[model samples]
Structure formats: C-alpha cells, structure tokens
Target: MADASHTSYLPPILIFCAGAVIAVPLFRRLGQSAVLGYLAAGIAIGPSVLALVNDPDAIRGTAEIGVVLLLFLVGLELQPSRLYSMRKDILGAGLAQMALSATAIGLVGWKFGLSVGGAIAVGLALALSATSIALQVLEERGDGSETYGRRTFSILLFQDISIAPALALLPLLATTGAQNHSGAPALAGLGLALLAVALLVLVGRYLLNPFFRILASTGAKDVMTAAALLIVLGAAMLMERVGLSMAMGAFLAGVLLADSHFRHELEADIEPFRGVLLGLFFMAVGMSLDLQLVFDNALLLALAAPLLVAFKIVVAATILRVSCSSSTEAIRAGALLSPAGEFAFVLLPLGAALGLLNTQQAALATSLAALSMLIGPVAAKLIDLWLSRRAGPAETMEEDFEGAGGSVMVIGFGRFGQVVTQALLLQHIPVTIIDSNVERIRSASKFGFRIYYGDGTRLDVLRAAGAGKAKIICICIDNREAALRIVEMARAEFPSARLHVRAYDRVHAIELMKADVDFQMRETFESALGFGRVTLESLGLSYDEASLVIDSVRDRDAQRMEIQYHEGIAAGIQKVPRVSPEPLVQPKAKSKALTEETREVIEDGGAEVAVGGVGEPER
Candidate 1:
C-alpha cells in the first residue's frame, strides 16, 4: 500500500552513506581531502546508476542545513574587534578586491550577452573564493595562522558580510525588473540592517556575555551548545525576516558573542556538527551532479569553470601583490584562493529572484560554483608543489638559525603565553619568542621582551629559534592549526626537546593527544572552573563536600578517558600500522588465515560480550 516514490528514495541514502564510509579512508590515505572523496562517491552512485534522490527540493532543503552550519562557524570567527584590528586588509585590500573583481567580471558577463543585472550578479558570484576550502587548505599547509592566513581571512570576512545586502537587493531588483528597479526597498533593507546592528550592540554590550557567564556557572556543556545554536538560529531568522540573508544575521550574532568566556567552548561544541553537516551538504551537491548536462555542454562547462577561477586568482593576487612585496607571496595568495565559495550558492536563489538569472542559468551557475569548489583543492596542491620546487629544499635555510642563544623557544606571546614567559623570565631563563604579529612584536620589543617576527610552525623558523638546542619548546599559539603544525614539526625534527603546549580547551586537548602531544594543558581547562565553583561553595562552609565532589569527578573522568583512548588507539593500530622501516605489506598466508578467522568469529558471535574482565549479555 506504500507509495512507489517513497520506496524509490531510500536506496540513494544507503548508497551515499556506504560510499562515503568506504571512499573516505582510501582518499585520506592518499593525503586527499574527504570533500573530494565525497564528490567522487556521489558521482559514482548518482542517478545514472541508482537514482537515489530525485526530489531536488527535498535534497536542497536537507543540504541547506550544511550551509547554515558553515556560515554559523564563519560568523563565530568574525568578531568586530578582530575586523577592527585588520582594517587595512579588510577595508582596504578586501574592499578593493571585491569592487575590482565585480567590475571586471561584470564586463566579461556583459560581453557574453547577459543583461546588466545578470552581469553584475555573475560578476559578484565569480569574485567570491571559497573561504571554507581556503581556510582548510591553509591549515593543511601549516600557513593558516601565518600572515597570509590572517590577510586572506580578513578579505573573506568582508565578502561574507557584503553578501547580505547583495542578496537582499537581488530579490528586489528581480521583482521590479533590473532596468526599472527602485532604490527605496534597498534603503529599507539598509534601515533594517542598521536596526539589527543597534539591537545587537545593546544586547552584546549588556546581556550576551552576562547571560553566557550565568550559563557557564551551571557547568553544563550541552546547555552551552544549545544556547550557542539558539543565538545563531535566532539571528539568522531575524535577518531572514528583514529581507536580509541568514548568513549576515548569524555572523552578527557571532561577532556579538566573540569576546565571551564561553566563545571557545561554544566553538568546540559546534565544530564537529558543522563539519559533518558541511560534508553532507557537499555530498548532496555531488548527488545533484548532472553528468548529462556536462556531456551536452562539455566544452562550455570546461572553459567557464577554469576561466572563472583564474579570473578570481588574478584579481585577488593583484590586490595582494600591492599589499605584500614578494612575488612568491602574491602567487601563493592567488593560487590558494581561486575558487567560488558557499556565497555563490547563497547568491543563486537571490539572482533567480532578482531576474538576473533564469532557472537554467541559475542551475548552470550553481553547477559551475560546485565544479570550482571541487577542483580548488587540486589547484592549491599544484601551487604548493610549484612553490616547493621554486624555493628549493626548505632545509637549506638552516643558516638562518645562527646567533640563537636562547635555551627555550616560545611560539606565541598571547595572553596565556605572556604570563608563562614572564614567570620563566622571573627565574632568569633564556627564552626567545617567535610570533608573526608585527604590532605585537613591536610593542613587546618596546617592553623589552625577547620576541621575533616569524611563524613558529614553519620548520625554518623553528630552527632559527635553535629548536634543537632548546631544552623546552612551549607552543602557546591560540589557533588550532598552528598548534598542530608545531607539534608535527617538533615530533619530526626536535624529538629530544620537551614539548609543552597550551590547548584551547578539553576537546582541543583530545585532538592534540591524537597528534602525539602528550604534555598538553588546556588554556582554560575545567580545573579553574571547578575551583571557582568549589571556592564559592566553600564560602558557605561546604568546603570539604565541594572539594571531594570536584576531585571525584575529575579523577573518574580522567581514568575513564585514558582507558578509552588507549583502547581505541590499540584497535586502530591493529588495522593500520604506522610508518616502519619495512614495507607495510601483508603476507598471503596470514591474510587468508585472518579472513577465515574473522568469518568464523562472525558466524559464532552469539552468546556474550566481555570488557575489562567483565562478562555481559551481547545485547
């Protein structure tokens, strides 16, 4: 009695899930991003084979959640204060890049026979490079917290913020016919945006942080996550109601909560959810892959995708070249940032509503956007290879290390690190700090701290810090990618030095643990929170009880986590061995015997389960 359509849809979900799990590991082994693997899987199991998801609307609706999470995280990173600090990059270079690219690309579109409004829309869309992919690639290459990363992030932030007004204007223009559109609605939308900003300023200045503090006092991680999500979704809804984009609202909310005590905690909680949702979203994009369209207009699609990406590269590079001196830096900036981002997807519906793009044109645009994103990783890889070849062996730069007398190297001199280094200095320790912040280094030099302008994660810089001679290397970088890069390099190059690191918090500590950073300290771990809570309780004469409670909870959780960590690592080792002197090849006899043993075990797996010398029912 069930509808035929309902049954037909289940297969695609199954295929997609199965394909994701299988392809991810294979690609991961090849040092490829899972996003590319997801795209490949979708193509392999798409409509041509299984015809899994035929309802475009339903698929898009589900995939849109991914967009929401993606933007939500983007917003979290774009604090107004952070923007203020990088005004030159954000306002000067970023604004120039957007304006120039939009003008250039608009002319190109106009030459292609599109109307003015359509040309403008296409131009704006082409100007946006994928922030998510760009950030990820930078992180992968250990440059995310570098000067390039900071500058690139500033430009991306401006583009995201500008998207709201652009989107709002699109619908109005389309409805009124771009040629005859009035500016009144655009002014109204601006007014609404101003109102939203005023309200956020009031709430952020008065309520948001205080509200978060009260929530943190409860020591509930789930509550914090829920509150964070509520803020993002609530702001997004408000923006949508005012004919602005949800991304803008979400970003505004993030900026408002940027300086909160719970900011890092909230980010940690939301990151995994955001990552998985983004993967699903990208996979859904893969599902929407129309091979037929590509085959039909293969030449057009091919030429359009790369041409658009190249155009973006040229504009972004030219702007950055003016800002930076080195040709290597400029080319790296351009090569790393030559693809359309999630904003293109956001712009598509707006373009359609604005009458700038008809249905076919919009679909084609979306397809190009997706294609550009898919190939972006490969483009970045090629650029990195070119840079590597041109720069020669990175090891040859060892001469830069001469004159280093410090016994210790401090990677960052942020607030947490400042305190630690001050304490070390009080004991007359010879410590040299490596940091990339020009202003911070200037200020520190005036204050008479031993700080150098450099990226701590780069092997060359670490060597310049006399990493081999240092007795200890303290990595207190706030950014996660930089922290991991330092850990990786230290593990490979200076294995003898004691490594002490400051993690953002508990979850970041977990990730650092996976990277073999055994000595990790959470920058603001639960110890401080728990101590504060207990001390407050002690003021009421419940000191012993509070101390006992905190101690018991900490000890038990630590023990259980340690057990689980080791167990999981052991299980993983059983499956995939780490690098060894010998080839990781399995013997035929051993493989056959293991396969037979696994099958036998599966067949006889009925009665009971065991854990740590305890037996239990299998169920």
Candidate 2:
C-alpha cells in the first residue's frame, strides 16, 4: 500500500549502506584509511560498475549537505581564541601556500594552452587540499593537537574562508560581456555576502544559545538534536539563497556557538550525523568519477594527478620547513595535505559556467583531482618512511633509550604516569616513560622529564621504551580499550615485567584480572575508601580505630574481587555461607600455583594497596 515512488528510493540507500558496511571494516582491517574504503565502495556500486545507483546527481545533492556539516564541525573545534592565537600562521603560511601553489598551477595550465582566466581557475581549484580527509587522517594518527596538525588546519581554514570570494570572482573571468558583470555588481555581491555573514554571526551570538538552553531544559535529547540540525540547515539555506556557499554559512554559525556553554552538547548531538553524511560524501565523490574519461586518458590522468600532488607537496614542505625548522614536521604537513580538495568540484563547475573551462577540461580536471585524493594516504606513508630513514636509526627512541635502562616503564605520561614518575624519581629510582600524544611529550620535556613518544600497545614501541629491562610496567592510560590493549601486550611480550594497570571501574578491573595482570587498581577505589576514613575520623573515631575498620573493609573487598575473578559472582557468593564467623582474608601463604610477580607485590604491601587512579597520570 506504500507509494511506488517512495519504495523505489529505498534500493539506492540500501545499496550505499550495504557497500559502506562491507567495505569500511575490510579496508580498516587491511590497514587502509576508511575514507578510501568509502570511495571504493561508491565506485563499486556506482553507474560505471554495478549500476546500483544509476543517477549520481541525486546522491550528490544529499552528499553536499555532508560537506556543509563537516565544515560546521571544523568550526566548532576551532574556538575563536585558538584561531586568534594561530592568526600569524594562518595569515603567513596559509596565504603563502595559496598564492604560490595557485601561481605554479596556473602557469602549468597556461602551458597546456588554456586562457589566462581558465588557468587561474584551474590553479585555484587545485591549490586547496581536502579538509575532511586531512582532518580524519590526523585524528586517526592522534596528531590533531600536534604542531604539524595545527599548521595544516591553519591552511585549510584559509581555503575554506576563501571559497566565497573564489565563487564571486569566477564570473568576472568570463570573456563574454553578457556573462561578465561590471565591477559595481561584483562589489554589491561582496557587500551582500558580508551582510549575510554578519547577520549569521549576530543571530548566533544573541539568539542561538538561549534557544538551545530552552530546548535542553525540556530534557528531551531528541528535541535538542533536532534543534541543532535546524540551526545548521537553516543557516545553510540562508547562505544558499543569498548566493553564498552553504558550508561558509554553517561554519560561521559553528564558530559563533563554539564558545557557548552548550558547545559540547551541540557537538555530541551533531557528531553521528556528521560522520554518516561525511561517509556518504566521500562515496559520492567516488561515484562522480568519470571512469570512461579516466580510461580513455589514463596516462594523462596518471601524470596530471601525481604532478599536481608533487608540486603542492614541495611547496607545502618548503613553507613548513622555513617556518617550523623541522624536516619531519615539514614532510608530514606536505604529504598529508597534497590532495586536491572537495572544493574542486564546486570550483570546476563554476569555471565551466563562467566560460573558463570547457566540458572536456572540467571533466579532465575532476578526474585528475579524484585520482590525486585516491593516492593521498599512500603518498603520506611513503613520505613518512623516507623522512624516518633520513633521520637515521640513531635518532629513533629505541636507540636513544638503549643506554638508559630503568626499573619502571610508564606506558602513558599523562597525569597518572607523571605522578608515578615523580614518585619514583623522588626515591632515586630510574624510570622510563612513553606517551603517544606529541603535545604531552613536548610539555613534559619542558618540565625536564625525558618522556618518549610512541604507542605502548605496539610490542616494538614497548621494546623501544626499554620494556624488556623494566621490572614494573605501569599502564596509566585513561582510555579503557587502550588500557586493556597495553595490559595484553605487556603480559605477552614481557612476561618477566610486572604490569600495574589502572582500571576505570569494577568491570574494567575484572577484565584486567581476567587477563592475569599482576595488579589492577580501580581508578576511584582507593580515593573513595580514603574519603570514608576521613568521614569516620571527623565523626570522633580514633585514627587507629578508623584505620583498622578501613583495612578490614579493604581486605574483605579484595577477597570478594578475587573470588569474582575466577568464578562467576553467583558461584563465588555461594562459596561463602551466611553463618560464617571468621573474617575473609586472602591466605598469606603462597597458593598452589600463584604467579611469581603477583605474589611479590601482594607480599610486599601486605595487601594489594594502590593509590587513587581518578586523575590523569602526571606529565
């Protein structure tokens, strides 16, 4: 009884979703980027291949919204204060990148026999890098807070901001007088664009926060989410109606809300939508690729794509090297940002409309850009390998730490790790620490701590941090999954090293215990127990009496935890009768087959006493 028109729309959605579900996980498992997988999925199900989605235009329209939301989220992450702090980099490096890359590409286009206007259009389109892809890649590598990432983001921000003016300028490049409007109209259009932006900012600053607060007070999360969507879509629509990029408008709105009290709430509401749509956006890019054109001009497409990427990489690397003073950072910035961006689709069409590019030229440009993006990750990997080799084995953490063996290896140098490191240092005990966060490592170094940079879950990184020589390996990372992984890796690779893991909760503690970890401290257990002791003392109990009571409770809890570890709770509880008179204590004598490390820590403390795990490891 459903309308046939409505039912017909289901197949494409199903095909797209099915492709994503199948391809993303497989590609991730193969150690490839998920964006690449989404693109491959789109190509597989597209008209050129399976013909599952015959009309690419319809999907493109929907996918464009994804780009808008992506920009909006980027704006949300970039607070005004942060943007201001990086203004020098944004203006200096970002401007230089655009000017230099555009000029170079424009000359290339002119050499290929295009008009000056056409060459300029092509250059501008190719100068920008894919913001979505670059950000996603940075996030995957956990480098979003690193200096290279910040520099990359500064350039991308300038590109996004430039899109509006770029679109406006395209029409003026037309040779035909009818299409080419006079300077007055162009100025008027610029004024209108500015007004629209000002209006968005004003409304967002004054009206949006209060509106969201009211919606949030209703205690309906779905309603709050709906309001957030309404704000984005409404701003996008407003911008489109006024002849501006929807993404630009959405970004303005996002910036306005970035410093609001409800920023996190709004972000949480919008994330799922952004992710799904962004996936679809990448898939749409894949579907839009003209396979026949690529096949017919395979050699030209291949050469053009790599040439564009190469030129951009060199320009970016040189700029970063001059500014940052580090070749590794420079190479990373260049390689990661070499791809032609999503804006090329917008710019190329505008160029065609303004008589700068013919249909054939536009198609060629589009194909070349897509190919460049497809090879982006591979290019980045090659650059990283090259840089690492150039830096030499002596510069690596493994080599640096080889002569500085320590008794303790701290897996994370965050707040928790910092505390442990300080404590050991105060006692004149040697300690080696590693953290994956580049920013944290740099900050710790300023404080005179010699923390290394590497992921501890990798056995190789662990070995580099002197895990083999360490008597104790402390797993102090705050992330539950990461903590679990470190525990597993440490236990397997360094069976001789005792692992002291920080668990997030009772469930986490149980999981760590199940892994046969030498020690597992629930993050808040000792803190809560300490608070209880303070309350008892305040209530007039003697210090000795309070201590006895706390110790008794702690002992009983440990016994319960141990019981729950080997047997299910029901079975463990059944082992203890209600008629029992004696206190429950883990037998002091060695059990039948206790692990040597576990027995040692327990014997040394008289109980498995550990400090609170509530705060971050110190850096």
Candidate 3:
C-alpha cells in the first residue's frame, strides 16, 4: 500500500516540473523578474494547491544549500585587493546601518512588551537587508563599479562574514538567555574561526591552485566540477561541526579559490545548478507564506511592511551620506539599498529556532521581507526617472567652433573606423575617436586605440569632439536608432561638414538619401560576399566565375537596392496626395499684391492659406 501511494504521487511532481519549464520563456518575455515567477509557481503547486512537496522542512533544507552556494560564489568574485580597497565603505556604512537599525528595532520591540534579549535578537534579524536583491538591482543598472556599487558591496560583505558569528551567538542568546559565552569554550570557538582563516590562507597560497592544475590536466570536465562541489560542501560540513554557519565554510572555500585561474571555469560549471537552486529557494519562501496568519493580522502586517523597509533605507542612506557623499550620489545610494533582501528569510527561521522569536514575530518579519523584495524594481525605476528629469533639455543650437588644427575627429571606431584612424595615424591625422560602451573603452585603451567616451547624439558632445570645423565627420554608430538621431543632430548643427554614414540595410540607404545627406555605404554586405568569392576560388571554381558571382551579388545589393528605394518612394507618393486640391492663384503681375493681402490677413492672426506644390495636379 505504501509503495502504491508513492507511485500515485509521481504524476503531479512531473506536472510541476513541466510548469517550471513553461514558466522560464513566459517570464522572460513579460519582463517580469524570474523571482516572481518562481514564487507564483510554488504557490500554485504548494500544499494549499497541488501539494507537490508536502514536507516544508525538506524543501527548506534543499534551499538552505542554495544560499550556501550563493555566498560561496559571491566571495569568489571579491579579490583581496578589491576588498581591501573597499574597506572604508564596507566597514563604515555597513556597521553604521547594522548598529543603528538594530538599536531602533530593539527599542521598538521592547516597546511592544518583548523581553530585552528577545527584542534585541528580533531587532538584529530586522536590521540586515537582503543582499541578493541589492546585488541584482545593481547588476541591472551597469553601475556595479560605481561609488554606490562599491559601498553597497562592502556592507554586504561584512554582513555575509558576520552572519556566522551571529548564528553561533544566537543560540546562547536565545536558549540560555545570555549574550556572551563563558571563558574557555567561547575562546575555543573564536580561536577555531581564526585558525580556520589562517589555514585557508596558508593552503590557498601554497597548494589549492597547484592541486586544481593537476586535476585540469586530467582533462576530465566532471572531475573539476566534482572537486569544486566537494570543496564547498566539505568546508560547509566542517564549519557546521565547529558550531559555525555553512555560509562561513562555503565563503572560506571561495576565498581560497579567489586567486585561482580555474575560478571562472568553476563558476561557469556551477552556474546552471545555482540558478535552479535559487529558484527552489524562492519557491520555498512562497511555500512558507501562511495565508491564515496574514489575514488574521492584516493591520499589523500592513503597519510592519513599509516600516521595516523604510528603516533599512533610512539607516543605509544616512551611513552612505556620512561615509561616501555627494548629495546626488547619497540619494542614489539610499534609493538603491532601500529594498530588504533574501537574508531576512534565512534569518527568520534561525532566530525562531534559537528561541529569539515567536511564531507571530517571525511571520510578521517574513511578510515585510517579501514586500521589500517586491518593491526593488519600483524603487530603481524611480531613481532612473529622477536622473532623467534632472538632465539638461535637448540642445537645438549650433555648437561653438574652435579651430581643428591639431584635432582629428573620428566619428565611429568600429572595424572600419579603426582602419580609417590607423591610416590617418600613419600619415599623422592626429585623431580622436568617440565610443559609448565603458567596457569597450577600457579594452580599446589596452590595445592603444585613442577613444573618447560620449553618446554622439548630443550637440554638446559633438562640439567637444570638434564637429563644427572638422575636415570630415564619419558616422559609424552601428545602432540604427542612434545613427539616425546623430544624423539629425549633425545636419542641424554642422551643415558645412562632409558627412559619411554606415547604412544598415537597403531601406536605411533610402532613408539617408531622402534626408539629402548623401555619402553612405552599407557596412558589411559587399565584404562578406567578397569572402564567398575567395572561398569559391579555393573550391576549384574559375577566377572569372568567382568574379562574376561576386559582381552579381554586389550589383544586386548596391545598384538594384537603389532602384527599389526610389520605386518604393514613388509608390508611396502615388498612394497619398502631396497637396490638397484647393488653390487660389494669380499671375506674376498680381502675385506680390495677393501675397501682401494674405500677409495682412495673417497679421490679424488668421490661419494661413494652403497652396498646391509639385505633386498636386495643375490648378
């Protein structure tokens, strides 16, 4: 009977798996974050519905392992030098926020009639914001190296490190109702943690990579992956036995591997599993949400949610402003760190299990924590909107020209742009090229390419590039939207220049023609076809036959595409009338008098009269 019962439950598990498969593409297309979809799926199949994983403890156990991996990967990315450089931001803002928020929450809990120690434990739990949500928000903004990014990372690093000690201390605080452990055993735990750190440093420097190199030489991909998993899980198991959180163990393993050449390879191999397990973590969170508790305590839940998030935001912002300030950046830093993170979920159960929190308190904390995670995108969007509004209005005036005696301006520095710049340098053209991507700018600089950073659509940026009196302006922006905007700005601001442009397709060629700025070439069509011709020559085709094929392809693209351009324009004009069929006209002798009379009427602010032009039939 038990075997039959187990067999009967297999279909629903398969069905839930199918639902998860369908959710990935659906969530991606809708622009909804994957975290939301995971939560939804969990709720759909949880005990309240499909009941796929009826044992919450089992689900929690697996998800906890996911958190362990997440922290391990995070530690791997933070090199020693990077962490050292970030010390001020990390220790200053991180500790300030943690301390202030903890104090505020403890006071609040005390006011609500909790015991002093219980209140302090609950406050500490509430003080730590979600690191995962904060990191994700930063990643989306491309500001992962910006001032706020640096500061945010530092605080998160400290929290990650401190979580272990807190976990150890929590049991004493809750179970024994004491804050500090007695002499010998307390000294032993601290001594052990310190020893573990020392041992990791010694082994990592002297042995880990050499060991990994031998494993790599074996050329068995699974062996390397298995080794990585063992290192993380083994360290975690060791930490658990010594009364430390798994996070500390996993983190130590990561730090030891931080300088390894195999770090990137290991990260790639583990990424697929990390994503799955992270999803499972979110699912577990959803499963733990108790609808009955929330309904019964609606008012209290409502009050706690915003207050919880706001407290963190205020504390983080204040610390950032004091430690790393410019009014604008401080506000941005505050806005960025405003969301509560995934750590709160982990802390809640740990706090409760340690006897620091009651069921109601943990439930309230969880609800508010979930709400904070959901508000992240909304807060980020508000920051973006504020920044956009604060930027200067679009420029309509011509840029001031300075003489371009030593300045040679290269508009686009893509492949063709690089060739032009290099040729100019051989003859001494003294060029400065403009590009927008920050990463690309760094790479080009390493290769000794002269490049400036700016979006070319702004007239101010063009002026800075000496656009007004340049011998030539080359438009090399690959994106059609940006290219068209540049053309419009250049035409309005620098009409004297000879303009060269890259056409994306035949349709692009026609649009550039209609705009009346004529020098244009398709970027790669002819060159790619030429490569085909060379391949044909290598494949035993006659030179004449290959040349003929190349010529045919080129003419079809360059000449025939031109014909299609005008033909489409003609078809469009034929379909729509160019002018209205009403006109009032006079012979040349009376034309000036009629114009004066019309001008006098317009001086009284009347609507202007319509007149037919070339496309209209004779009137």
| lDDT digits (tens) for residues 1-619 of candidate 1 | 3788788777766776787888777877877777777777766666644665556786666566667777778877765545666788888878998899889877987897777788788878878877777776776566766677777787888888787667766666565664566867767776877797688668877898889889889988899888988888888788778777777777777777665646655765675566567667677777666777767777988998888777777778788888873667766777667877777877876787666888777777778877887777677677778788988754311123446648888889988889889989999988878877666777788988757766786565677668888888899989875686578668756878877888775455655666666477666545453554456465652444344334434454455446555676333322221211111122123222233433443345311122122362210
For this target, which candidate reaches the highest lDDT against the unseen true structure? 2
lDDT of 1: 0.70
- Residue 459's lDDT in candidate 3: 58
Query: Order of all candidates by lDDT, from best down to worst?
Result: 2, 1, 3
CA displacement after TM-score superposition, residue 400 of candidate 3 (Å): 35
- Please, what are the lDDT tens digits per residue for candidate 3 over residues 562-608? 55555775334222211111111211232222335434433543221
**TM match of model 1 to true structure:** 0.63
| Model 1 misplaced regions, further than 4 Å | 1-16, 45-49, 175-190, 394-619
Cα lDDT computed for each candidate against the true fold: 0.70, 0.76, 0.66
Q: Note the residue pairs that clash in candidate 1.
A: 174-354
Residue ranges of candidate 2 with Cα displaced over 4 Å: 175-181, 388-619
lDDT of 2 by residue, 446-507 (tens): 98988777766555567777888899989998877567656755665678998888888776
Cα displacement (Å) at residue 382, model 1: 1.0
In model 3, the Cα lDDT at residue 92 comes to 76
